[model samples]
Target chain A: MTRDAIILAAIAGAGLLTVLLFAAGADGAPRAIAALLFLLIGPGLACVRLLRLDDPLTELALAVAVSLALETIVATALLATGSWSAGAALAALVAITLAAVAAGFARARGAGSPRA
Target chain B: MAAGVPGPARESAGQAVSSSPGPAALAMAWPVGRAPSWLLTLAPLLAALALWLAAIPAIDPDQMTDLGLIAVLPPAFYLALGLLILGFCALLGRERAGDWEPGAYIAAWIVILHGTPAIVYGSLRYAWAWKHVGIVDYIQRTGGIDPAIGYLPIYHNWPGFFGAAALLTEAAGLADALPLATWSPPFFELLFAAALLLVLRAVTGDRRLAWLGVWFFTLTNWVGQDYFSPQAITYALYLAAIGLCLWAFPARMPLAASPVGRVVIRGALLRRLAADFDRRAEWAGAASSALPDLSTVQRRGLLAMTLALLASIAVSHQLTPIVTILALFALVLLGQCRAWGLPLVMLLFTAGWMATGASSFAAEGIREVLSTLGRANENIDSNLIDASLFTPGFRIVSNAARALTAGVGLLATLGWLRRFHDGYLDLPLTLLWLAPVALLGMSSYGGEILFRVYFFALPAMAFFLAALFAPRSWRRGAASLIVVALASVVLAAGFLVAYYGHERSNYFRPGEIAAADYLARNAPAGSLIVEGSPNYPSRYHRYEQFVYVPLVAWPRGNVEASANAYSLADIEQMMADRHYAAAYLIITESQKVEMSVPGLASLEAIQGEIEASGDFAVLFRNDAATIYGLAGRQGAEP
Candidate 1:
């Protein structure tokens, strides 16, 4: 598979697993591992990889920062709107992640080449 | 060969002349061209880890001296750190040490430095961290912020970090945020190192200098702000955003021609100080030209990323966004950053947040905030922290911290001059270093503005500190190696003393945790929790359910004279207040250490007074803490 496909697959797989785990009310190590990895970097990485910033460390750092930004914004919005739900927040993040991946793939397909 | 040539030159000359080499020559020559193998270099790292693991169990927190953890930490711990430093330097000295080797070493250094406290304590160290945990717990429980909450209203006003933490905590299926808080120091330190690398690489094209800058940053950062707090996350974001600005937006305009640049250049002292401005201008232009031209799409992506970082920072921290604005403005004014509109955008976000989301805090604290404006000298003086009030050991720790700060500053000055003489004038770095100093004139930040300034300045200062020992060649000489190693060791020692030296008051024993847990579980809503000092681990769970009354708050200056002059009757009367459903007074070891300063009754003395008074009953007693309640009050004892 292409690098892009592999990245999208990982993000999608993790996001789905996170949603499922939360849905199942799973706790402890399994839930912790899946949720932390996805929440920490999944959504942000999905978006940042499309930027095609090849420097690994910079990419990783920005991914974490962006993930945190998205999480904070989503959570804060839910909070300020007085409709706070961890499940809802997680669902929003997963939706954002999948949407970002799809958008990146479509953009790449439209350009007829991967981003440099 | 010249007679006066250095030994390194002579060795190279001799090798060049010899056509046929002996075993010794082959042995010596073989490794010269090859970097050390991964196994050989990683061995020290493994050994260091082993030593640290071995040393962990031997430590007893009870035996900790005023020197803090350094007083009780086994020599193996120090040796482990030394080995890590030596291993890094050895790899760094090699001609072909690639990114992976140095990077791994720095990561290990951070683990050894920041992770040690977490491992040893096996609990969260700082009271502020616990308070942050409480905020997260509150958010997780309530699912919304209460901006007008009586306790910790400031945190409610700016709840980005807590909100994100709450999401992670609930999502991760954790019981509470205690574990997250426990390991946050190293997590944030690692992030800071990554962000610092981005910023350093943006300015200097030298890869080795950039890496060394990161290493120096790890060693010299003794400010201890890399805990579980909003400042830690926002500081990292600030660095990343500035890095993005520097890399993506090098100014096209000449520095001397900009309005602020003109004023800076026209100053007689600055003119005299930087007589090499002509050369600096030429070098800066060359550097800016050397930066790769980014495509429009990439620039847009980077700008979006910068905006995201800035927006998060604006909401997450009150102080970092302001300092970030100052930095961006300085960068623009000095013609180092071409993104003139970015600072204005950051200001708008910050001001917008202050006007809307944080209006409650702004409204309440605006007068106090305005009072500190332009009182730069008083703000700086607020950080003096009278060591005379505490134990002599803290005096030593405080002095060591001051000395290290001064030492880094002095070395940075020398390095800047040396780099300037070598035809590299780091104007952007100089401005970055000076930008946070403007904060000194803004607010004292409750006597901590100075340390925060030091924290922000240390990145650029680390760059210059590394430049002081920056290798003249790809392969460093033995003399330079020894100097760098020794300097690192000295800085690391100072770091241990300065960063971990206050563990006597910061660490909470298991018994203390148990007492706190008991209170959280048993104390009903609206219960009054009277604490000896606000230094212990309280309010981590069900924090808002009770009214907390601490005898002495920080600054200890605003405390009424009656509080200090409390008799047994006064203590009884305070805890036995009729209005509250129940009242409990608890004191812990950490509070005793904090309250041992002059003019305050020691917690032990207060405990004795309470026990002597027959009206109060002992509800809970542990080796590390004690809780007391009114003897005959209904529902007082669980």
Candidate 2:
């Protein structure tokens, strides 16, 4: 139950913070943090979690590597398909990040015995 | 153990140990015990983080040994590294945190250690990034390619990295890639760590060894290739490819004696080589029995995914694709795997891209690369001897870099000899280590091929160096782990003696940036833009709007634009030329920094010389930089 709450809260917090970053006309520090979270870390962790490696370090490393490659792949695909407007690119990344996180949560839950 | 098995069988988790020496022998390596408290172990790490964060605010870029030299990053910077080393050893002192624990812990330490210099000194260090950012800006605005650019025109050919950055910057609502450039060294260094760890884990099959390898790499890397450039991205991709190959394929060659009849070669040398290969092939076949059991479909999937990665690498950088090709070929030649198709595929992608897309560099025929071979000795000499010509203080720093290189070279050699005696040097991976050295013969790369060679060989070199601490047996105890930490910290200390020691040239003052920004706003399209030299962040945004010409392309052989001894008459003559647009000259902090070195002309002297002649007027001037307009040009008055 505690684990589930933490996960849910984290998801909510990150999502809310991202929205705030976009909506609040916030410029410097908050925006930089958001970039780190949304652009690099959160999505990276999400991908890493899905790999299901016994070694968390390997998974984390692999995830970071995958995240970079994913960026290149997603950006390339979008550019190849069209002009790749800012909105479209953001949407694609957000969707990918959210989906990966969701999938990772599911995998983590399945791996663990649910108490609640 | 067949740990590389796909998801279904991977749950077995390394239980299928075959011919890996007996457990009786391996059991002696580590003491059986619970790990020490995480909180207690990590206290030093916490302290190190605090030291780093505090050091950032305390840093005054001007206070270095020489002005702006990295030696002045504050005492806390070095303290943080020392704390990391001690903290990490404490973390590994107990044996309970699982295989990834040390990996995770060391990774954090890497972040702190590598990130400090970048943070303390703001903006990207390499002037090359300014040009790179400029190229991306051009691509963003033009939405098309123009391979006619004078410098690094090949970057125009492979536009994937720039195109990706363009999209990200636009989507993220950032001004430009400057932020990315400033933050990239630490970020990319971390990524390189991950990639190195992955590759080490795949090859060594021992997590402790892998962790040690990652630590060694973090300590020894001074090449500064971790800048915001395609090479950094390409390097990570190359590592991933090697890692993935080792993971999926797992090196299972056919036995030389049983299945295939030896084809008789006519020549004596050929026969001897074939016989030697046969014996190694037999040993490799025995080793192959330990490989993972992958379904053909899964193998195919891995192959396809890996090929896509290769294609991406080929599309991104100029030299990495060729290195990837050589490394892949080396893997096969060492009887590590039978992925003969991989090198061929990479070659095709590399050649096709160069021939059709990278035609700017490729216009002279592949002969350009081929002709440059057999000059490795010259490249090395110039790189080591000539490039070290800097200020006295900075020379001490540069020599420390050479010392660090020599030290690591010694450690790796000792490790190799030790592992070779034990008959466990990991030949396929060693081949990967040797393969990038082939690049040394290919290009001088402006007398920096030695640095490039060191960068290329770094990942593989780290793995070998790790063996010095790695036990003959796989199991590791607190004692061995302590030694490993000591090795990393010692090497890291050596690295610190010089790594950011060139901070003077690397740091860009806000004044320089502001001057560049002024030119960006004021310079007309196709204006003949001249600089003190090709350094600092000037054409970053309006890269396409100007024709860049530099005052000094020194170091003996660069084409001089002014055509005279850097004189006022030369400046007047250049300004008088009826080119498409008028000429403007910029002098930034970089040129001022470069003046401390031998060959680069003194920017201060140039400023006085031009002002004394009254042939040029200050169109723009700032605290750290200045822009000059030729006094007698048409409409020259700003």
Candidate 3:
């Protein structure tokens, strides 16, 4: 594959992974493994992608996404532990999702593109 | 430079890269000749003066004189002192080119100067309320009022001092009292605008950009609403410190003068060495020889100015520590001081003098700080995390949409940062500029109180964004679109949220004016009252001046354990002991509602006693508040 294709594929994969991790955690089917998967997959993939991205906008987006995902996952886990309520968990999920998607769009628009 | 390519080729290349207009284009596109400079400066002040004058018909002249003196004097004195200091600075640096345009600077100064009254007023109101709201409760619990008002009273209750001083100075002379508190909102707003201009000027070294910053800070609805609070006063001080630090200690230049000459010379040289030892002193002997000695009066004037600035920080403690922290960080980042000795010494001095009171005050709120921090962390965690790689289609789409919206603000901020750097603005200074964004995002308080703290940061934020998006070329249509887009988002989020969600809420407005008017008109002669709601009492009446009880029983007689709650019982006892006529209970929608406390049943038991007493009557009830008056209570005539 060409470099552009490779970059696009990576972006797609990262985006897909983010969605999957969130979906799994939100399902609340298996507590431990789902939480573990969320901790490892959602933020971990975003972090790795952010560090590896060559483009500034892409990197910023990934960073924001990772931050949001981490916040959501921890909040959900805490809620499941009875530290927080379900309403709070839902609000966190919504806010995080919003922040992540916004970051992604900003990145795609090349808002913080690194100047040569 | 290469010879110009074919026009179409160049044009196509530009179009290919990006369609958006740059910062230069945006600056030029704004209407330049909107309001005359003098009119802009005097408009708010004159309006406030007019309002005060208008109030004279309603208020006694003695009260008016006291209010006018208290509200107007400090700010006027401060502005005059500021001018004198500026003049002295100019005398000291005669050789320096008058690089700054007088018109722009004066315009900016006028905008800032007009805000002094507003800052003083809001701060005074907040401070007075802080002391008065729960005073009766303290009297009940501690057997006397805490003279300190919980924290450093000097800085916190500055308005009271102004008011008292004014009254004392006038010796009960009847003069028309201006509604100084009412004027506070617009005055500080003007200052917030001026500070933005100063920041932009410091960053871009362009008067036009400075003007743009002013326009953006003032004209933008989101920023304008935020500036109308005591927080603006703190912000103005922080910006002033930034300006002073920037002007006093600029970037170090290579010195043409010998090391001896550089050492002998002070001011900028000391700052450069303090900032970065590696910096070469670039003083030309010709310039040095041409400079004249500043007069003793001028030197004294400079000293006075410095003292006054330091005193201003002491007078307002809310943002002083934050300002100090930012200044320290900027100085450290600039690599001015090789050793930590000077910083340590300065820190010691501040801690001993200016910051000591603030440190103690913040310390008192340590429990609150910790709880707030914990809640903030929980909020961040819950709101930011998600589990699935893919969500329900609608959920996924919505999340993406919201994220995109949030990203616009972030992008605007980032874009501003880039432009600030490009304009040769200092990086450390920019970090200080960005401090408010972080503060706003981090603060756990979900009210105007937190927003007030965040207000100081808006000037920097607006100026940075304005400078950041300024068009580099004449073609500004595209840039104007971007500005509109970003501004709309900011307005929708900041102003709409504040207005619709918070300001309109019963908790914020609380119908203070109406409540005050009600008590003034209807309450019987010499009525003894206890205001049930802490928020209500703080808003409507001065608790310190009166003997009002601040506690009340709810529908089922639920008792609140807060300090204000205890005041109700104290007021009842005081009424019985002092042979007062009746008790007045002022309840707002926010206060009458049930909260999440478990041990409220005991407090509820008191409702039977309150109702059983034949003395009480439901005196007033409206959508905003319900006032209960004990029957046969004689109200005091004001």
DockQ for each candidate?
0.69, 0.23, 0.01
Q: Give me the overall lDDT of model 2.
A: 0.64
DockQ of 1: 0.69
Name the lDDT of candidate 1.
0.78
Residue-level lDDT of model 3, residues B1-638, one tens digit each, is 11321111101012222233322222236574655533433333344344433433342211212112222233344334233223322211122212233233333333343343233323222222233223222222232222245332332322222222122111112111123333444544544444444444444443334444554454332322322222334445445445433433333333213233355547876756533322211111111121223344333332232233334343333344344554545444443212223234435534544333334444545444323222111112212324142223323332432343244346447756565333233443445655544455444444322433334444555555554554443122344435534553443333322221211111222354366557745555446556544334242233333345446433221122233445345545555544654456665543432211233333333444565665556677666565666555454222
* Number of the top DockQ candidate: 1
For model 1, how does the per-residue alpha-carbon lDDT over B1-638 read when each residue is reduced to its tens digit? Answer: 22322211201111122121222224455664564456665777889899988988988877887777888888999899988887777765565556777888899989987888898888889777888899999988887889888876767777888888998998899989898889888989988988888888787666667788999999988877788888888888899899889888877456566658677677777766545564564463454332556777778888988898888887787778888999999889877788899999999998888888788778867545333221222112222567676577877887888888889999999988777766666777888999999988876445556677888999999999988886555343545666778899999988888888787778889999999998999998889888887778988888888887777654524321225424677667866777887889888998887676665567787777778768888899999998989899886888
**Stronger candidate by TM-score (1 vs 3):** 1
Evaluate all candidate structures by whole-model CA lDDT and list the values in order.
0.78, 0.64, 0.37
Query: Which candidate, 1 or 3, would have the higher DockQ against the true structure?
Result: 1
Misplaced by over 4 Å in model 3 are A1-116, B1-178, B219-230, B252-307, B332-350, B353-409, B420-425, B434-456, B475-501, B505-529, B537-542, B545-582, B588-615, B618-626, B631-638
Q: What ordering of candidates by DockQ runs from best to worst? A: 1, 2, 3
Task: Put down candidate 1 lDDT per residue, A19-85, tens digits, no spaces.
Answer: 9988999978999999999998998898888777767777788888888888888887777667888
RMSD of each: 5.1, 7.1, 25.7
Candidate 1 scores an iRMS of 1.4
Q: Can you tell me the CAPRI class of model 3? A: incorrect
- Residues B1-638 of candidate 2 have per-residue lDDT tens digits of 32331211111123322212222223334463443445444556777788888878877776665523445567887788777776555444333435545655676676775666567666666677777788777756766456666655656667667766775565455778777777777778878888777677666545555677887888888766777788888898888788777766666443232112233354678667556554443342333332345556446645655776787787777778888998988776555656767888889988887776566767866656433321222112222546547667656666677888878778888877765554443666677778889987776556456566777888878878877775443333446655766787677766766566666666787788888888788777768777777657766877766776677664543322433247767766777677737678888877777555766667778778877987788888888888888876764455
Here, model 1's chain A TM-score works out at 0.92
